[model samples]
Target: MKNNKPDQQLASRRNFIKGSALAAAGFFIVPRHVLGGPGFIAPSDRLRVASIGVGGMGAGDVRGIFSSGKVDMIALCDVDDTRAKQSREAHPKANYYKDYRIMLEKEEKNIDAVSVSTPDHMHAVQALMAMKMGKHVYVQKPMSHDIYEARMLTEAAEKYKVVTQMGNQGSSGDGVRQMVEWYNAGLIGEATKVWTWTNRPVWPQGIPWPSTPIAPPADLDWDLWLGTAPYKDYVGNLVPFNWRGWWDYGTGALGDMACHIMEPPFRVLGLGYPSSAECSVGSVYVGEFQRGYFPDSCPPSSHITLRFERPGKEELEFHWMDGGIQPTRPEELGPNEMMGDGGNGVIIEGTKGKMMCSTYGANPQLLPTSRTKDVSLPQTEYRVPGGSSGHYNNWVEACIAGHGSEEFKKLSSPFSVAGPLTESVLMGNLAIRSYDYRIPRTGSDNQFDYPGRGIKLVWDGANMKITNFDPANQFVKRTYREGYSL
Candidate 1:
């Protein structure tokens, strides 16, 4: 009664006693088996994680994070029980919920990190919420649904001082690192052009939205699944997959694969935002005389050209072809050789020589292909453990190490890097969407003129605006539904 002591000191003593009792009883503590292996990490050193969208790609993400053995899977959230079955069965002990907001509210003190693997439209909202809470976040590719969202997430990461990673595993692969070393060593001098191609849209695109609506599955919460996206009636085949082709819910083929295919060139050349963008898209035929125009759906194919300005150097030309289109084969490559992993790949042209690689920067090769075997350079880039496969653990360990730690700096696709790359990828979409922009003909009710077509869009990256085409600016950011905000 007479002694005066700080509340913190008294609380510390109480915590010590409580911790000791829990350790002795093995209750309210990590199991001994979980921390007893040869390289066991203490419970205090482990990262406690909660995952949203635990199904489809989300299930794989969950497995990858848990495989690290340096994390505790504390909670799981998903809108569809059917899609969440695999992860739920795999982590039976973790708390499960349908709404991520409720899960975060109740478990905020329990989770140290969050993994977001939802559709393209939902990525930014889920990730922003976690980062605002000072929790580390690992979000799937493209990082966001819009350019403005990408920019915001990038800035928020720094403001909150939280660890972050984008789910582009290829960024951590040995192939990209090797390419970096080669470029730094001048294997290909002064890159002037880059070509990236992917045969995606494996789902339906260049088509009209389904006319009839159907009831959502019994276990699926359709409203929750449409988080951040404008409300629409349930359409069959749009769930579990196939959302990639819709402008409302997905970012189309460019968003699906460019992050993997174009990353090598972006990293190798140290490229920034593009100064301009233009594109041409393939059209579908509705009848013998009519060209089908479904503005809401992504086209079947597109060829986008983006130009980047370098103050002291020649402007760089970047090409992106999707839906089976590819650049002309380099003369140095053999006629019969496969190009870009046979479906997706990248080629960089330089003033002196050229190099190429498939998606995820895998199988990098000099133009001749033969040069890849003969040319060698010292490895200047530090390799992440397990290469691309170890991407999940890299983030897990980094989160455990905390922000500003050495491990955090080593993250392959942190928001600082992934953010710009995502912006560039989304730029291609902006051009594609602009190519489809239409205006009602001066006096006609049905006929329309496509003014956004046949025009190159001038981009002001700093302000995230399209200076030449005001209509295209609408695509830079989207208005969220009533309850969702960045």
Candidate 2:
């Protein structure tokens, strides 16, 4: 008797991955039942994967996933062919597409996971779509462009029972865990003040949007590239990297580097959302007569303060400075000692002592260089096998092992941890953006009232809202474009 059921044929089609003949024929799969049943995936079974925005950071992510030796990258997508050219040449067999939606639809049966490394504005939408289709996701840091989106993805991961990881590689580093061990060992007493800074926005910020109306590059799909953001004329430099300086397409320096700098303190202090947030942005001189007020772009530099209510102690005061601004030298440091790894660093001031670390939570040290060498603490946390670079393989193996497996729980920056951290990080930007919100003063054509200035915005973490300032609430969640809804 000849037997050929449709479901069996589909399963057969979905089960043959990584063969010269199969790939050359544009078919990829993992022999479903041959490896193992249900939760037990075999060592030889390769997870089929896809990537969106395979250029720049996207290209790095895809390459890392492929390097893990646990997955077969079957599809690659990007809006700009020029940007994706390198990746295409590297993985010519993996189907390439300019439209992610079409790629997902056509390859749904073959893909086991998706990596999203697009612009801040598009991350949530792309990841959300993949999650809805029961695909595991690895998203880049800051979780999302909005606090609401972060919360949604956090909840969705649990709802869909899909393994998830955020691309804050530092969260998996030895430095952060070592700091956590030190903090838990009471080496640094109750943390009362923390400061973090970076020299970012090497791109232009705090200026009017480029008014030049020019055609977009032939290789770039301007409409698709602007996914989730409002339609606008093409501007040079904004597409490749300068977008980080704009509010509409990016989240400024906070989004650019805070996830890397702040993860250590967020983990060691065991902090959550701040009770109140405030900031002071550096001003730019637009014309000789009046100061510039460009809401379209981020400020040239800024200093922000976030207050958290500690369960048993006084409130914690955390400061964030960017655009090369740094705190005064700590007395514990030597005159020649560089503060915070130079250019970017973090300082945690505790009731009894202080600790500091450089970017990516690397090269941690105690104040007064002598203390760093003198003190020793137990390694209380499990060290990530490959350290920071192991971040990609960590997620890939987990997806292969199946969601809710023991291996899955060991992920470094799962949505569970990343969501609150992202929400808290984005909180600082809310304060910075609010500083620019204004209204015209009544009966005065010559004057304007800045409503968001000079106030501490009280936050309701549970609801993701700004209880004190109504206007600032808008940033907690944004209105997406018509086609892209979360």
Candidate 3:
């Protein structure tokens, strides 16, 4: 069945191209309705798209592009045959290649945009290369593995006149828009402190190294998978999905979830890059092996606090607690409005009244409670016009029409916000790796005195450098493998 699916996909593409040519030639033609509907642009008018790293996330992206009717999927690229096969089956009419560069060089003009769903480490290079070719880009979240790449991609997107959207799906949802609405409404006064948490500490939980290498999968090109990271023999356990836990490939739990968790606080508060950020480690994972592989023993769950000294007056602190972490609720919050365990959300404590929101607050409804009863929120419905379809649809529309509209911008324009948030999360990961260190922390609630511990690191956004701590800056920028320099 799997083998037949690829063959069928290929046949459908060949037929579509043949049929499209006939219609363009002014000959009598019949519509087959390849995509979900016929309202989208025809194949000839569609943007040519190329898919890179078409495995899990990549395959889903391919489907989105093909279904949008805004683009014709011309190429499928991936290091793994299993995923490549999935994309090929989903888009048989497009050319297929194992290596993305080969597809880029071979089908240069055949593509107008590139959808990149690779690992955290490969995002910067793939997107940068596509932008350099004048191709629009839709990359997955945490935009880049480090600060330098994030800054570079943001600049390059502007320079190349390409439309860009980072793939934080929540960024394209109504929930995020509602968060913005509530923030604008001042439901949370002043917005002094923000707390976000995740139930991570699962795969890469608590700063541990990965296990030893195993034989690479037969259908997978392991070397290509490693991409820009330092070469390590294929570890069977790490590939496919566990990459999220390792320092070399993934951004740990904080990196994986912070973009989603931090969006509300950033949008509502209009917070910029923090002047300083330090990580506090409740438990540490020691040894170089810990840096390289997953440790057999898990590190204790801990909270990472990031402090920002805002422009106006007092300092603001955003605490990111994960691995079974919860925030200390303000006394004002009703008993029933208390947050959930094994779930994710953010709590904003303000002087006037406290505002609580979950990570996935689908449709702006608060968790029902008797004591809290029904807190009347304004009946404002903010919809993601094209996003109701998919994240790639918004990008496809923007790519074809030039500039993204206000709605599209509102949906996917969190790159600037997500960039700094990712940095703070990565910094937290670094702090945890530094073992048990009493780093300095300053920032109080309501001008009250409060002292804390963690490595107090200062940041210089202008220079993209974090001073006062050298070790903290180690993860700020990454080096490229021999041939993959962007």
TM-scores for every candidate against the unseen true structure: 0.93, 0.91, 0.80
- The residue-by-residue lDDT of candidate 3 on 293-405, one tens digit each, is 23332244667766777777578888888777687755655576547333787776664455666664333333232322455557464566654356667677777767546
Give the range where candidate 1 is weakest over 10 consecutive residues by summed lDDT.
Answer: 26-35
On TM-score, the stronger of 2 and 3 is 2
**What's model 1's lDDT at 246?**
95
Task: Compute the lDDT of residue 429 as modeled in candidate 3.
Answer: 60
Prediction 3 global C-alpha lDDT: 0.69
Off by over 4 Å in 1: 1-37
lDDT of 2 by residue, 1-486 (tens): 667698797877667533556778887566765556666545456788899989998899888889887688899999999999989998889999998999999999989999999999998989989999999999988779999999999999999999899999988899999888888888878898999999987889998988897899999999999989988989877988899999888999999899889889999988888899999999999679778889889999999999999887999999999998999889999999989889999999988899999998998899876898998877779888899999988898889888988779889999988888888889988998899998889999878888999999999998888997899998888887778899
Provide the clash count, candidate 1.
Answer: 0
Task: Tell me the spans in candidate 2 whose CA falls farther than 4 Å from its real position.
Answer: 1-44
Per-residue lDDT of candidate 1, residues 1-486 (tens digit) = 756668879999999999999889877755675769778777878999999999999999999999998888999999999889999999899999999999999999999999999999999999999999999999999899899999999999999999999999999999999999988998889999999999998999999999999999999999999988889999998998899999999999999999998899999988889999999998799999789989899999999999999989999999999999999989999989988799999999998899999999998899888998898787789999999999998898899998999999899999999999999999999999889889889989999999988888999999999998899999999999999998
| Highest TM-score against the true fold, candidate | 1
In model 1, state the lDDT of residue 429. 94
Indicate which candidate wins on lDDT.
Answer: 1
Local lDDT at 125 for model 3: 89
**Span of 10 residues, lowest total lDDT, candidate 3:** 444-453
lDDT of each: 0.93, 0.89, 0.69
